[model samples]
Target: MIKRITDSSAASPGALCRLLWESMLELLYPSNIYCICCDNLIDDSRPYSLCDDCLTNLHWANERTCRCCGKILKEGYRWDICTDCSSASHSFEKGFACTEYGGAEKNMLLRFKFKEKAYYGEKLAEIMFDRIQPEELDVDLILPVPMHKRKEKRRGYNQAAILAYHLSRYMKIPFRKNILLRSRETMPMKGLGAVERRANIENAFTVSRGWDTIIKNKKILLVDDIYTTGSTADACADVLLAAGALRVYVLVFAAGANRTV
Candidate 1:
């Protein structure tokens, strides 16, 4: 009896091509790939890791912004200042935010924080770097605003740390993770007035003992994902300044369009 043999190549060209393509993909990209915005399969050629539709929907802060804080400012507004900054005094010598907290930008931030899409940090950092003026940013260290130990353990990562790591790489600054510690975990600052938020975060942070020597008379760039009332950043800056940091500047990915106090 003669047995019929199947030639794998002759069986199906499409199947063979698919297998080769899949192998190439495995070698080229991450296994669990998905769109950053819509959780759909990402196209191999898209510039962003987001699907086309979601990428189109992304609203960049493509307008003029406050030089001090990166908040979107209307056309004809005075240069270097926004209404909010004009009225308020910020502890951070200066700040930079990439986008306003609305539309796709807001969604991306939410995903980054609560959904573990930590890779977004790189993209956000890129945007931030573009907005920052290199001549104005001479810093000795990149310090991330710390999350409390309990919260850090629960999340398994701090978003600010991720942002700081990327910013450090982009800016060539030393990234220090343990220099600042969140000594307390206060209630969420959302919905609270600016004064309340400041009060809540006051005394919530402390610089680690050895950090005093390292940061003494050194310029620092504090990295955070958001700047709401500036409470968290202020608290961190206060500790760093008190510990002898020469100057403290903040870099955030987003900030409220309208700020009070």
Candidate 2:
């Protein structure tokens, strides 16, 4: 989670450094000057800093999404839930995603996560903010899927927290970064099967000790950059629910295509 700043003039040293870095990024990659997806020039009128071609090509998950996981289902499939959700249970009450994890989304999200393009989070979150409005979700608080301290320090930022921060600002919901934490780092989920992923992520999250009162009986929106097997979200949701959260809903920028079989 990004550190909270009570005041700009008296920011903590870490906050001050992030502020300076953001300022530099603003000058170098100002919004409305370049498209976030295809890098073509775009005007402010284009939403989310996307060019017309990229916007047209972007795979919006506007149809046939799995009811449980919110991943785009295969065309003409006669199922309400995806294959993964049908085969296993998830802790999250529901899930929402803005786009399908297609080629364009994969490229853009890779840049946002691995490249020094933190500003891309703003555009992605703006799109997610739009997605949330239609759902009419009434979450009491927003939190990000946490990263282990060592890994976060190595990466310089947590992509999920960046998305959650922008979402909190757009939705006016209170955002808490330190509540749910990644207690340990596990092997990267890439190339792992669903069972392996779940085992890898199990018991990897824990809630802060003193946040029970605030979490009790409250609805939570769990923010993340992507949703794959739902292992990561399920682990975090299990911890949050154990800490007394009423319901945990997941919101992501992109989701993997639903399995047909």
lDDT of 1 by residue, 96-136 (tens): 77666767777888887786445566666666776565546
Number of the top lDDT candidate: 2
lDDT of 1 at 97: 75
Count clashing pairs, candidate 2.
0
* Tens digits of per-residue lDDT for model 2, 1-261: 122222232122344566567666666666567888878998878888899899988899888888998998877888889999998999999999999988999989988878756667777888999998889988999999998878777666777887888888889998888899899989999899998999999899999889888899999999999999999999999989988999999999999888765
lDDT of 1: 0.72
User: Where does the lowest 10-residue lDDT sum fall in candidate 1?
Assistant: 1-10
Provide the lDDT at 8 for model 2: 35
Candidate 2 segments whose C-alpha is farther than 4 A from its true place: 1-19
Per-candidate Cα lDDT values, in order, are 0.72, 0.84
